[model samples]
Target: MTAQVKYDDVEVGTEIPAQTYQIDRMNLVMYAGASGDFNPIHWRENFARKVGLPDVIAHGMYTMAQGGRFVTDWVGDPGAVLDYGVRFSAPVVVPDEGGAALEISGKVEQKLDDNRVVVALTARSSEQKVLTRAKAVVRLA
Candidate 1:
């Protein structure tokens, strides 16, 4: 897919629109059913605590996907993202009462050759960063 944004019009520090995605237990259950990652740690708080986690946690991939969503929505083409990666720096603790919120934003980090640019991402939950060194290399129109 071709990006709607033009590479020539993009600046090195341009900010992508920020987005916040809410994750609840039901969401985790649905993702578990779809991804077949039925780890008890993601769905059972008591089991998670027994295993050393503070609470039921959202899947790391789920958090990372929010970052991807932020980038793709800004570029206007999911297929325009050539490369994406992140390091799971912290766990997103989903409490039984309110679940969790994943906040994502990106900036044009650098302009690459061939109409491609590097996007730096930040993903946070409850003021703590969940993803670090997140970036996407996107090919723009």
Candidate 2:
């Protein structure tokens, strides 16, 4: 855990520190089991190829969760998040060997009433394609 972010200390254009998340086949498998989303496109390479995917792709929700992690870690408490949403803009291609790395970043876009802030987030893979277009509303102390 980290220190709570005081509401008065943040500005609309302030950028939150970025973080990287590594995703591999094992991670996808584990997420599939945990989330009960056993879509073969997320695991079986042959199915992915048959479906015209470049390779076994990471689950969209998994990538979104990683982006959520970045924000939750920054805000110090998951309970501080009031609302969060994202659109899966691109598929995260998970290679068999090197896997894929996601770099996620956030910025305060607006300050609402009652010490709330709207955060805009961007998540990209190594190929520079945006994977998740996310935004969240957080309540600050």
Candidate 3:
């Protein structure tokens, strides 16, 4: 689908609506199955703790995908995204009880040529920054 947002209407510093995604053990298991990243640290608390982690943690790529979802949902087209990248900073610790909450937000950082804009994103979980240097380049309609 084509992007719903127009390049002419966008400005640097325009805010993308924030989104919060719930990540639980079941979700991690499903992600592991789908991604083939069953490294145990993502699904087994014992293994995670044995490896020096506080608890079972969400996959880094899963967290990055949430950031991607935030950008695409705002720009209104997944294909509009030309480039996306992030550095994993902290883990999203999932306890046995309630799921963890991953909060994602972004803003247009630069308006580039060719209807493209650079977006700076922030991802946080459990009051700790989870992803650093998260950014996406998107082409608007």
Runs in model 1 with CA error above 4 Å?
1-3
Tell me the tens digit of each residue's lDDT in model 1 across 8-108: 99999999878899999988888899889999999999999999999999988888887888888888888899999999999999899988989898899
The predictions' CA RMSDs to the true structure, in order, are 1.7, 1.1, 1.4
On the 0 to 100 scale, the lDDT of residue 79 in model 1 is 87
Off by over 4 Å in 3: 1-3
- Which is better, 1 or 2, measured by TM-score? 2
As a whole number from 0 to 100, the lDDT of residue 33 in candidate 1 is 91
Candidate 3, residues 1-141, lDDT tens digits: the string is 435999999899999878899999999999999999999999888999999999999999999999988888888888899999999999999997998999999999999999999999999998999999999999999
Per-candidate TM-score against the hidden true structure: 0.95, 0.96, 0.96
> Would you give me the overall lDDT of model 3?
0.93
Q: What is the lDDT of every predicted structure here?
A: 0.91, 0.90, 0.93
lDDT of 2 by residue, 1-141 (tens): 999898999999999988889899999999999999999999999999999999999998898889778878998989999999998888999989999999998999999999999999989997665655589999998
